[model samples]
Target: MAGQIPMTRNGVERLKEELHQLKSQDRPNIIQAIAEARAQGDLSENAEYESAKERQGFIEGRIAEIEAKLSNVQIIDPSVLNADGKCVFGATIELEDLDEEKSFTYQIVGEDEADIKANKISISSPLARALIGKEDGDVVEVETPGGQKTYEITNVSYI
Candidate 1:
């Protein structure tokens, strides 16, 4: 539960693409900048050299972090899931607020792929924690920043 990260196929590819870009493009560019800065002499007084070194450090850190996450990933295809209509990771769920008369839809995903604007919520989020293992037509309570609220699940889909 703690070590392995659950990620969709698309999410895995996106992270991999970011790692590749940081390594193949950003890394080379920063190295080139550092070389050029070294040619200008005095590194202690060189802003360009300092900036490039900082950027290189950031890129290298990100590369390692992404690689570690990728290595511990448990890739799951939502389309292939069979949860018997119960809400689970990778499940797209629709909920209707019983109080405010509003509807919300979200797909439960890994932390790396969570984007509220895109309707993707992290599995560890408060609402997601409440929704997991729930079924359609089930009423659930969640503690939001706006205080406690109730929602009735309208639908749950793996895709």
Candidate 2:
């Protein structure tokens, strides 16, 4: 399906962790807060009760969201992937900026696992798209908002 989301093993684990936190921690805490607020309030004029209810609604919504994602997640472990050294999903790649002459590392991952600050880029990103199917030592030119930039693939690893 067009909406099907692919996730790495780590990404799925992270989602499960968040769901666990929301269920075991946030859910009970909010329910207790609501009970406390209800004991001190008249039905229509209780701001504490209203706020607690709103928070409960948000928590329940997120729990449902996480459950849905887990239900449909396809976990792929990058460490076991071997594409004969060609770049693909779950590849850790090292690149040298042709213009800047600076080296950096990035791992191509699913949308949920993509964190620019952590140097994990989404597979759908322009740079990732350009790098896909490319082998080590290949030069790729990616179009960005700043314009086209060239990068040389220095290394590619599955791990």
Candidate 3:
């Protein structure tokens, strides 16, 4: 089945930049390298030619992959999201752990843009799944690998 690939505006921009670089810089560089290598010798025994050809293949493959990703991207802007204090895609949510009374914040984002160090969780993650549709003061239960945990929604905002 075809799956959705949600991406933040920044993520989409990054992908576009990468695609542009591959097409404009990397592609031309590899073509030149291949041409130079081919000029040096026989078709069958030229190691440099073989290496350059391999590099060209890899670069082309990456270019195709990036193109496909860009084509399928669904861009989302956090600043425009309006869930009315309810957790949703592109929402930055504050939570208080029921057991520890400690607070944490996480932004629900797409898988491609999820970064644990940045406190951004994918929309399809277990924690995000539990938090979705919940408003401030709502309590959500999440089933984690460690155990069942409960968190109280403290705040939800876009951006």
TM for every model, in the order presented, reads 0.96, 0.92, 0.78
Question: How well is each residue in 7-102 modelled by candidate 1, as lDDT tens digits?
Answer: 988799999999999989999999999999999999999999999999999999999999999999999887787899999999999999999999
Q: What lDDT, from 0 to 1, does candidate 3 have?
A: 0.87
Q: If ranked by TM-score, best first, what sequence of candidates would result? A: 1, 2, 3
Best by TM-score: 1
In model 2, what lDDT does residue 86 have? 94
Query: How accurate locally, in lDDT, is each candidate?
Result: 0.94, 0.92, 0.87
lDDT by residue for model 2 (1-159), tens: 336678888888899999999999999999999999989969699999999999999999999988988888787776787689999898999999998899999999998899999999999999999999999999999999998899999999987
Error of 2 at 106 (Å): 0.7
Ranking by lDDT: 1, 2, 3
Report each candidate's C-alpha RMSD, comma-separated, in the order given.
Answer: 1.4, 1.6, 2.8
Cα displacement (Å) at residue 117, model 1: 1.0
Most accurate candidate by lDDT: 1
User: Distance from true position, residue 69, model 3, in Å?
Assistant: 2.8
Evaluated against the true structure, the overall lDDT of model 1 is 0.94
